[model samples]
Target: MEATLKNLWSTVELVAVAAHSDVVEQWDGQTLTRAFHWAQYCQHLFHRFHDNPTIRRVMEKQLQLVNESVSVVFPEHTAVSFSDLSRCQHLLLVGLLHNTKLPVSLLRILFDTSSPVNKEQAGYRNVTGLCSSMIECKSACKVLSPLVEVSDVGADAEVQGVLLMERLEALLSQSREPFLDSVLQGCEGAAEHFCLVIAAALLTRKTAAAQTTLEDFLLDWLLHKHSLLQHMCYTLPASLLTDLAKRHVKFREAYCNVLKKWASDMEYSISDGEWFQASTNPTVSFQKLTEHFRSLSEASPSLWEHVENQLNALKVSDGDFDVRGLSVWGDLLSEIHK
Candidate 1:
């Protein structure tokens, strides 16, 4: 048993090195297949030797090495590269990472690494472009797409989606501050990519199940846990919100609820003068907030009344006197009424 375990561990190490090699030629169908086989074998060994600590410890160490290698190599492959071969390799690496059940920390690294600084840059273009192309290809739409297949493991779109969410939940439970900071610091598309991935995952579920999952994920995990609603309201692009609304009736309702919560929060902030102190230029903040409200109202007329009510009730005052003279609230209110 010891000899067999040593041989298996050596093979796993070799496969890990080859998978992460700088030589793009080292990555191909064969290399990917070997990775899957090694991962499966390690899983099998761990389970089969459930009573044997010696074997389990060795296997665990090997798996940790594999995860570490992936963490180091992923950023290199995901870097701005238009080469189809490099893209293909990157996609394959993603498959292996998922297959191995990547830890939440490594998954966070993947999210941070792929997140685009802006829509025009390579990171944003790569993620969105890759997703679009994968959909067009009609690949299974697994979290990473069909460029690499996991059908042998019996993981369909729904299962993959759930797994992705589980990892996200784990990450959120650990700390949301860093995650939010990543998004707020110009990594907004990371949030959008997450939405795109989840939407794609929902494509395979029956309507009822999909609706329930989307609502719980959006409300429970995103809105309540991470305070993503604020980012959706002010930072993230409207197109992502529009796409999600179009995806499902439940999504639209959930989004409106998010907007309601945001409005409530904003109202409190305004009433308490926190809104003006939120930034150096309260005028810019007010303009963006109202503009977002306008877009949402146009997209979903049902929200117009709620939006109008919020805008109409926008009154800012300091202690005894109205702060309208000290701030641009009056001018902003006039623009809104127009």
Candidate 2:
């Protein structure tokens, strides 16, 4: 096993060097194919002999080799062709997601302002590819699964949660609209798992200071920007929702805070007429918000008080809000009363 591992490591190193060398010429597809083939084999070995310290360390070393090669293949501020970007995407998917270890350094590379993957046209394709790869990689699910498991909840879990949140924030921070849209779409299928992971991680935060930063990011990026609440309300299992609320005060508070912000924003939009002006169908938009709120309330009964409080505050401030000729506010008030 040791000999086999050593040979695989050598092959990976040789492939990395070959990829860098082929940068000036037409990239050898066989080189990439060989790289992936070896990587898949290594993934198998790592999983099977994960208990073996030697195999694990060697695998980490192999992954590091691949990670370093990425920077060489796609240098900073360089114009990368679609083919190169596509190849790099596959390399990243294999190096980052396939491994047991979190490749923080590789993420740093990808998020670097000058990294070719962050370039306008190429960045979109690269980001989309990476996000798509993430959705397809069952290993990523396995890696993140423990973070949400009730049995696995602990200090270590909290640390992992914080780490994951930090990395996700970094990724989102570097992303723009269409690229961001691609990410949100990729996340749709795994939305429940993503929400649970975030919830679990938020609950594990040890300090108010730490929790606040993550909460704001979740609200700004995930919940508000990506419609994470919609996903959570529609997809997250009811039992898990109850479990999360029952498990930690922080989780419930964070969730309520998100709802409060949405209500506050909606109230402002309605008051200023921006909500109606921005929407082709203000009534439909109002109805959707009301329905989402209803679903959210039903999914987590603990949040009902917070929701009601916010709605009442909005009602009091607006005094029978009307959008043009529509009685949307009255409709919302009626729905809440029911």
Candidate 3:
């Protein structure tokens, strides 16, 4: 299973590269037959098809036709390859980051089926992009075509939030038990990951209905596990962090502590034309920041709000704010303020 999945990943990588060079207009019957065989024999292996640029473009052009008939006509599930392309993180990231307009409602469903491990890393990354792209696309489309509904999302935010909250609940609910088969073995790391996913959901909140899920997860699910706050204040974009800041005093303290830590940790430069350099590795610092945000959002209710305030203050503050000193974080914070 693993080897086949790996091989298919290699093939998908080739398809991604090919996407830049040429377009495959149509698949002959034989190619279609082979694709069907691959799908039937390797459902797990074929997930990587999401990364293919050519395939995604082809799918988008045929979306209306394929969406209506393929699933039923290909009851053997052969035509799932195109749907699989919507789920690929690398390809999805390109679309999301580069602002490619492709229907990605399938992503919500694809993520539902992703493994917890994948969900924590690449899945979270893709979801972040998906939420952003979906919002951008919806807004642009609403302007371009007023009569058409902008969002075609079927997955409710509350449901998505609940599912994510449950994972954190599993870790906290089992904290007292032995760590034999639990995700709590690395609570710190897991909490960080949870924040990233939660932030993705938070980024897409357009209506009261969408926010209900985030609010419930925050107020009901996260507050009990308090340690998560200290992690988020340092990690997530300040704007996103502000969501939690309005709720928790402890999270506020943690946010201040993280800033204090960052300030104290920088090595003072004395020479002429000097700039500050952090004693801690910048990459590690950024990772820690992400982990902090994830942890706080998963465990503390108000950390996001607190983070946004901190970020905003930093943006407006005078010389005390050394922008270039904090490389990765500075760039991220700059965008949030913009």
Candidate 4:
């Protein structure tokens, strides 16, 4: 172990085991808060190690050490505030994100469902909010871009796209209306990132959990948001369309509606939308869709249910669904049901 990682490993191990009870009482508030942020930054270093295979291997060792240290020290409901545990987990997530070989679907679950201190939504939103200004996004994406094409229907790379989309969806679902709405506006670019992040997630073996997460991302998005359905039907080809259609009933109806719209208006397709056009390269297009999909999937079930109820109240049916991609999805869905 290089002295640097060795030092970090030792420090993390010591800090990791210092149970919540140990910190809660002595909490300096500001100091611990700062430490939390510092830890997250360090974890980001591990995230980037994927590009440097040697560093990644070293990071794998250090990561296990750090994770074990934290797990032993924290151990769920061990008198830690949701805030603190979330901070720790969020730090871990940064590390996980940079660990490019991790499965994107697995990472998505870890981000979406793994609420260490009940702040997964805030934790990710805050990171994403800073992603544009932070150089980390560009750096991380460069490393991960090859692993995930962000385009190419049913490609393994899309799995990473799904995970990111799911994590963001969970976050959006939990956010307040105004805040959620604001995120929707900013989410386009953030989604494009994580080709590496998704790739990392995919690198992890495909377990049932991983596959379920993939399913969850697909079902969650299709069932909840029309925007994503709009994106997929227009941009993705038959394979993805078929996967989604086989999974849900409402999506089938919605897909049909989108196809009908495309037939009606050649000038306006989902591809023509600002979000879709952010990058014309298929890779870029796929990244945009992935990001949008993540944002849509990230919505919390409670909040998502509320959105659904509201849409229902407005009687928003397939007739009103004008996204151009819908018909491809419909074609796929129709085949699945058959």
- Give the best candidate by TM-score: 1
RMSD of 2: 15.7
TM-score-better candidate, 3 vs 4: 3
Estimate TM-scores for all models: 0.42, 0.35, 0.30, 0.29
* Model 1 segments more than 4 A misplaced: 1-15, 20-32, 40-191, 196-210, 224-236, 239-285, 299-302, 311-332
Per-residue alpha-carbon lDDT of candidate 1 for residues 72-119, written as tens digits (9 for 90 to 100): 755432221111111233434454454444344433433443543233
User: CA RMSD for every model?
Assistant: 13.9, 15.7, 16.6, 19.0
Q: Would you give me the overall lDDT of model 1?
A: 0.44
- Kindly report which residue stretches of model 3 are placed more than 4 angstroms away from their true locations once superposed: 1-86, 89-136, 140-240, 248-254, 266-338
Best by lDDT: 2
- Per residue, candidate 4 scores C-alpha lDDT tens digits across 190-303 of 532322333333333445664655544445444465664455565555444433434444554565455444423322245554223323223333333333333332334543
The alpha-carbon deviation from the true structure for residue 263 of candidate 2, after best TM-score superposition, in angstroms, is: 4.4
> What is candidate 3's CA lDDT for residue 297?
46
TM-score order of candidates, top first: 1, 2, 3, 4
Lowest lDDT sum, 10 consecutive residues, model 2, at 77-86
| lDDT of the candidates, in the order given | 0.44, 0.47, 0.41, 0.42
Model 3, 219-297: lDDT tens digits are 4433454445445544556645544444435445645565546644544344532334355434234334444444444
How much is the lDDT of residue 228 in candidate 1? 53
